[model samples]
Target: MNIAILMMQKNENELLKKWITYHSYLVGSSNLFIFDNGSTNNQVIEQLTNFENKEVNVLWDFNKKSDYEQRGSIFCDKIKSLDKEDFYDFYMVIDCDEFLGTVDEEGNICFDPLSLEYSLLNYQSNNELLMIDSQYYNSSISPFWFNKQPYRKCFFKKNTIAKLDQGFHHGQVTTSDKEIRTNLVHIHFHNKPYEIAKTHAKEKLTGRVSNFNLDYLKNYNGKGFHLVRFFLQTEEEYIQNQVTLNHIKSMSLYHKLKQLNLDWPFSSTINETREKLGLTDDDDSFEKVLPKFRGSIDYIAFEGEYLKIRGWGLVNYSRPIRYIFLQLTNRSRFRFEIIERVIREDVNEMLNVRGGALGFSARLKRSDLEDLTDVTASTAIVTFLNSECAYFKFDMQKKHKEFNYFSPNNLAG
Candidate 1:
């Protein structure tokens, strides 16, 4: 049974090497298809060159764009094209931080190729898209942090996959009643060790992910990539607390196995390995700061079921404001939604705000409101870090527009 593993990465040298080694063992080194995401690391480039000589098909980005959905979709199309030629019997696309394996009756996680093949083939999934459940681990505080809904990865049989959306978060199968679960689990080291995480986050948020998109912080595919505020807030905590690598991994391993009711029989070996590598929580690192909140709403528009707005904000002191509250009133009825922050340097400059990139623009869907007809009025508000808030209300029915304390040419006072 032939299998092909697909992957895309940029500058995650250590994790990328581990992923390649494990997957190469699962499927032969020759069958791995790696797409280098414009990585600048000399180690990564050198390794890719070595693999290329070893019959691994190393690919470069087809689309120059950094958007994951677009790039991932293009990769899936390439996979489908390869499937047409009957080159491989199965395909799996995964991230560098993710490791694929199966659990045995003795509760041992097996990374052996034969074990993975058996798991995939023997597992019963009525749907063509086989869903591999995930075990997500946190970087700092709670090691075995359990998500209420852990995401599932895809393992496609020959001709089973249609295409992947939003970087493999969901699969659009050609013919399938619904996605079915499989026993295969990919332990996702999503929370990178602090040092690596800093680079990864910048590459993702500022580079590939495009923080300028309106849906930047909105929840997409239950993954909450859109929850930009959550990401930022958590990052702030990590920096403030100075989270460490060893602590995260150690705690996660201990608690995750505990949650699975499995025993960690390799404790001595693990410790020895760590010691040999000189790994320590004290040495792990991360560094980044979220922009403060305190600006003005310079633009607002209503289109169909969506309420579009643009503004700039920045906090002077204390804890930064991470979210803005939008309140709507209709004949004693009230509805509101929390808006996460986004990059907006142009407006921030126009408003003469000291905080760079204080501008936020979003297209929010309001299913909560029956109609904009009777909405009567709305308020755009931002509370300061000290619990004091600045707000402005406008008549929604009469089409009143209220620019905050500042306008395009005028700075906020």
Candidate 2:
């Protein structure tokens, strides 16, 4: 059967090369369709140059900006448009970090092309979207740090899907009860090197922050808040240490690598993947140290049901601070949930700290503030790193000299 695989790309050069090479070997390079999302990096540009006159087709027509909703809409619409062309038998949409492979009924991963094709053929069903399960490999933890779950990527029979949701996690199908489950899996490299993963985190949060309005901040706590925390932690020493550990662990796995039919050029293991791509591993050892917290609550105020806050905090030995809490005391003390963390590079430079995400910009809900309203100027406290805390005083009535005056132009109707 003819198969086409679709993926979107930005600046992930190394991962992109492995993806292209592996998928090209699985299905011919002629069937690979990559939508270049306006990559400006020289390495990616140079690599794209090598594919000229090659069968691999790279299209540059999709919207390149970081608006995910619009980009996702364009992606789904493009797929629907391609479905009309009648060029291929089946289609799969996945991210660069994901790899498509097949597993046996006993759950052993298959690497041979014939075995993979046989499994797909046996599982194929009409009027259904095949839901391929996923196994997330967190190399930062260890090469063996993997768990299999029902998280799926779409493997669609033509005309089975009407449109996919934003991330292509699920879709609106052409008919009800239209899913065909299979042992096909997408091995997800969720955590990569610090710098690359950091860039990815920043891009994701930027898209979220730009599109989600502040009026809905209360309802946006869970996923949106976690993204901010992750983006802030991108530069910390712990992440760096985990990355080094993964490399070290993968080296051990490489020594015992068993032969497979396909002799797969790309590995789910970080060290093996790097070696296959001709990249060197860092053999240097890193020491993990406990973090000590010390921070200041620079600004805090109530703006309707939303509380706006800003501050700078740091760990003494350059470790990442995961969360910061705001405790308000009256007849009773209440601790509010932190909504977001911000990177404070200026704080780091000024303090001469080696590493840490030392700044934060957060929003807290007034309803969650509860009945603890006896908060005077001195009742507000900020805490971090479990044991360290700081308190600051501010005018609740907006009468403090630093915050008293304002000039306005257009009024909301």
Candidate 3:
């Protein structure tokens, strides 16, 4: 079947490359449709152009709208045009931050979208949509740590007549009557405090956002949603690390009444759906399943200063070395940012330091220096000692040798 993946995004430069890579791997580069909204980065356009030349279709609309209504209207119009041209048999509306997953009857893991029986997937909603819990992680503050809570659902299937709902959280399946019951998992990426703030700010500014309340989202306590901790050490660690990561759930009845902004009583709708599905919020059936190591490293610290982190860990081979160093000299606390700076068994150059290499540096302010020292002492340092590197001989007493920090730009030769 011909399947088209639709994505609407604004200022999505950070996720653009990785999302495009995953989409290209899933359905090939030819079946993707990207809609850009007010993106400031020209690099995104250039990348999309390259993909278009390779068969992907890229559409651009610069109209600024504070609500999803305008965005959805534009999306629907574009999809209608594509449908009239007989571009696709089935189209999936996916978010830039979500990754779709499929599971079998026997509960085997399948990551490929095309490998599953796509006909069984069904979209259900109450007056309120059921929020799925997710974990939040920050690279700078916490060492790749994650907390979990529930958030609103944002995936749906569309045919020619399908249009997004008023709040833009769910969609109406207008053309199909198929009672498909496929289970698809949504993996979200907004896990940091800064990320949460930015998202909430966007939603508040954009009046057309989802109707979901921000308060109900709770923090995950290291123990991921529906997963239990195992092993003596892990159980102890779980108990010790009682930190809450951001998660969102439907508001309680009283809170729902207090924040009664929507027309329908969401509490009642949620109850009815829960009863119909024979599912209880307290169901912890998945707790017995041991957490599988997806080979994800939560956080890496280097000298309590520079940090190299992957939200979901380093899953792709193309990811460069995740090593950075924080330089604390008399002048100031300089963060040396390096991306793939490890050259043919030697250090190349350093990107940013307090002062240029081979130069005398001034002292930092007393208060700033104290603060930097405190941060450096508390931060965790991660080093890839296993990776190839050259040994440097330094003369601290002689003060005779000059050294240069390694950076990508300096090594470009």
TM-score, predicted candidate 2 vs. hidden true structure: 0.54
Candidate 1 local lDDT, 81-129, one digit each (tens): 8888987877888877776676443223456678877876664345567
Worst window of 10 by summed lDDT in candidate 1: 404-413
Residues 1-413 of candidate 3 have per-residue lDDT tens digits of 55667777666655566666666666667878787765666887777778778887677654355434355656566667777776465555666755444433222224464653352233322222222222122211222222222233433333434665433455544544332223444444442223333443444344332322443222223212122112112322432333332211211212322343322212343345335545354222112212211122222322232333221211011122233223334422333243332222111122111111121111112222234433343222122312224211111221111111222121101
TM-score for each model: 0.52, 0.54, 0.42
Task: Sort all candidates by lDDT, best to worst.
Answer: 2, 1, 3
Q: What is the alpha-carbon lDDT for the whole of candidate 1?
A: 0.55
User: To one decimal, what is the Cα RMSD in angstroms of model 1 from the true structure?
Assistant: 17.6
Error of 1 at 308 (Å): 59
User: Which tens-of-lDDT digit does each residue in 1-413 have in candidate 2?
Assistant: 77788887787666676677677777778888887777888898666656635778888765356534554556667667877897766777888877777755323455445766787786556667677754434454334433333465666766666777657777666765667666567667665655556567667566456544445443456434544444444334534535433121122112212321222223444454455445453333323222234466666666666556666664432333445444433323334555566667776665444223456666656665544333322244445343334332322323322231121221111
lDDT of each prediction vs. the true structure? 0.55, 0.55, 0.38
Error of 2 at 200 (Å): 1.9
